[model samples]
Target: MLLTIIYIIAITAEAMTGALSAGRRSMDWFGVILIACVTALGGGSVRDVLLGHYPLGWVKHPEYLVLTCCAALFTILIANWMRHLRSIFLLLDALGLIGFTIIGCQIAIQMGHGFVVSAVAGIMTGVSGGILRDILCNDVPLVFRRELYASISFVSVICYWLCIHFGLTLEWTVVTTLVFGFSLRVIAIYFGLEMPKFIYQDDDEQSASSKDI
Candidate 1:
């Protein structure tokens, strides 16, 4: 239904952005498609597996895989222009994050899971695609260090739950989650907001010995 269409748009946007990442590495056509697929669908696949939700979507509807590959190929043709449209891509990426978060929460809710599991599902769906893409591209996972991306997803789940708790309709919950989550994500990206980094010291053993003395 409406959710399915939004999911399509989300994956299309994600695949295109992921193709740009492949372009950065100067990967071959196959590499481009692989990265795009990982970025667009890996999160949902992981979420389903973790929740024991079988017959994964892309598996059930192989056309979704075809869509991502085609989107990546199309992006290759427009790679140069994408550089000038980085902001647009950022917006789309943020939208994808919110869309994924909402869908994940919905799926978990349908399964009658509690709020904690629902929250985990939302975060996993928001975060895993980028993590897979980064690992494949040999980049640090952006979710682990970038702007409040995963945190926003977590927050979105809580907000969605609250909306349902207050007896809001599906339409209201969807709109509110999209607006609130997308706004928070885009603002965090614009402001370069980040959680504190935990820097590891190479002098750990030395510090421990000093403490013993």
Candidate 2:
């Protein structure tokens, strides 16, 4: 039941993000709903399949689909009233990412998975949906580009693992991790915090060549 609620919230966040992006692209209502559902469900589907979680979470709980569809539709209807969909989208996406990361780690731990495995699973759960969404939308996934992205997931999972190791209750551990992760991402966005650029192996050569010209 709790997972179901989490999935609904995840879908709502993705729906808002998609609707906002779609509006910027001038996509119609159908496009918005489709993108939202795909963005929200894609990662969870992959995770379940990879973990051999039978029936998949969405298939086992059909109301999740209903929730996704409704949430996507409702967000689209109200999107026009918002003056700055971009900001809202960023906030919602960060929140959903945080919740997904925490829940994924907790679920793995509940199933007796090790900390390393749970951390990786949590990062995957947080980023994979957005990756798939961007791929389908023909844009680069934000995870691979600048911004805190997957690092936020990594930090969050680590915090959760620490709390768990310290004898903290599962609920509080998750709560703290979610708050930490969400706050970090929000701050990163607000302050334009991002990953450092990777200088390619031949960046020096390229720079030298350009300078010579």
Candidate 3:
């Protein structure tokens, strides 16, 4: 029940963000709806396909797709006020990331997968939608460039696995992971923290490496 609620909230929030991205590009209403649906449902679809899980979530529950489309239209209506709600949207996006991660991890565990596969599932579910959204928008994917986003997803999976391994109740584990991952993401955003970039200047070493390749 809790997971269902979180999933709904997460997808709605993701859809809104996707709509906003489309708006930034001056896309039409249809484009907004398309991007919103992809941003809300793409991650789960990718995870299910990779796991060979039959009957994808949106496919099985078409209402979720309806919800995302509604969310997209709602965002368009409120586009004027969105600038003032940036912080709120960021927090909601963080919540969605952790929620998606937990849902994916739980599903994989239920399928009797080991820790590594579950972790991958969690990370994919957490980040892939935003990746698709950014790609469609022609922007760099935030998961790759944002401060501690995907890393937090992975860490949340580890925390969730540990909680379950140590006999935490499912409810408590979800609550704990949500708090931990959400807090980490909020802090990362506030601090503008980011993973170190490896900048390889084109020089003799790079030229030689390219030639070898």
**Candidate 3 runs further than 4 Å off:** 204-212
Candidate lDDT scores, in order, read 0.91, 0.77, 0.94
lDDT of 2 by residue, 112-176 (tens): 88988888778878888778778767787768886888999999988988998899987788678
TM-scores for every predicted model: 0.92, 0.84, 0.94
Best by TM-score: 3
Going through the candidates in the order shown, the clash numbers are: 0, 0, 0
User: Runs in model 1 with CA error above 4 Å?
Assistant: 204-213
Tens-place lDDT digits, model 3, residues 1-213: 888998999999999999999999999999999999999999999999999998999999999999999999999999999999999889989999999999999889999999999999999999999999999999888677668899999999999999988999999999999999999999999999998877766687578678665
RMSD of each: 3.0, 4.2, 1.9
- Candidate 3 similarity to native, TM-score: 0.94
Residue 91 displacement (Å), model 3: 0.9
Cα lDDT for residue 108, candidate 2: 78
Give the runs in model 2 whose Cα sits over 4 Å from its true position: 1-7, 23-29, 201-213
